[model samples]
Target: MDRVKLITIPKIEDTRGNLAVIEKESIPFEIKRVYYLYDVPTGAYRGAHAHKEQSEFLIALSGSFEVVLDDGIETRRIMLNKPNIGLFIPTMMWRELDNFSSGSVCLVLASDTFDESDYIREYDKFKLFKST
Candidate 1:
């Protein structure tokens, strides 16, 4: 299975504020679509599915949240609370997002446009696909 890891977005520090860049070299894949989650209710979760062809880059743009990733055999949890850091989720990895703090904003950069056929939403189905 492919490994999930964190990538640091290059930051330019300034006395006024800071800037984080997500240009071509920022991530491995070209960003085809962009979206974000905001005002998520406490205890609510997001993204309980795996993709077949699309890769994703997730950033905690505002507050904090936890991401649980499973590669069929093993599971991992990561907390995102920084705007300049991001998590890269490759294809075939099942992920669940949770523990969103108030006002948390999650920015996602996708490698491809939305396609229902590319999603593997069931955990059982995900396991079966990984076993093959």
Candidate 2:
């Protein structure tokens, strides 16, 4: 729902270890910022907001987690458990991260810099904005 997709990044395998690579050409948008979430307590949640124009790609670097996506019309849950897999999130959708396993590291690649004005933090307000 809401055009969310699971993307596979290029992975290089070797005897030493495995490597995953991500570039602007491999993703749908140019990455402008990068951040991560880690050390979250069990049963806790994060990212309960929606962006007006920003988009993001989320990757599970160390452990597993679930992403809850809502578009004001439908909802879907996506699991991120591998370093080479990413979840691409488009604009105008609400996202929440939860069900994180211990030692989970959530890496996010964003298409824009941090802009407070672009965020819609309330669910009812987001629905109204989506209708208009």
Candidate 3:
């Protein structure tokens, strides 16, 4: 399976800069939840897990970061810095986030509610589970 998918957010350019918008019906799925991660200390990492059924879109609202994604057989890396673009993560893909710039903000939009049971946190376990 492919690891990460990039969705081109529709951006309306302006004299000031640019603006991007995300609507529930416009995406592949409805937006059921929203969250963000920020204030990450230097040399630290986040999001070492995979979701079973939830799909998500991640945007770099500020600064920059790297999103590393892995399926059972393949892996991919994406650099997110622009607020107008988003990385779409499908279900059952393992992901790890790192290389965060100072004051970086990672915003995530989910298709499901907060459910710990939908997450696979261990890489080995995820690989094994995907095989079955």
* Per-prediction backbone clash count: 0, 0, 0
Query: Model 1 segments beyond 4 Å from truth?
Result: none
Candidate 1 is scored at a TM of 0.98
Please provide TM-scores, in order, for all candidate models, with all chains considered together.
Answer: 0.98, 0.98, 0.94
lDDT by residue for model 2 (1-132), tens? 647889999999999999899976778999999999999999999999999999999999989999999999999988999999999999999999999999999999999999999999999999999999
True lDDT of residue 23, candidate 3: 75
Tens-digit per-residue lDDT, 1-132, candidate 3: 554667778888999988887876546778889999999999999999999999989999999999988887878888999887899899998899999999999999999999999999998999899999
RMSD of each: 0.9, 0.8, 1.3
Off by over 4 Å in 3: 1-3
TM-score of 2: 0.98
Reference-based lDDT, residue 125, model 3 = 94
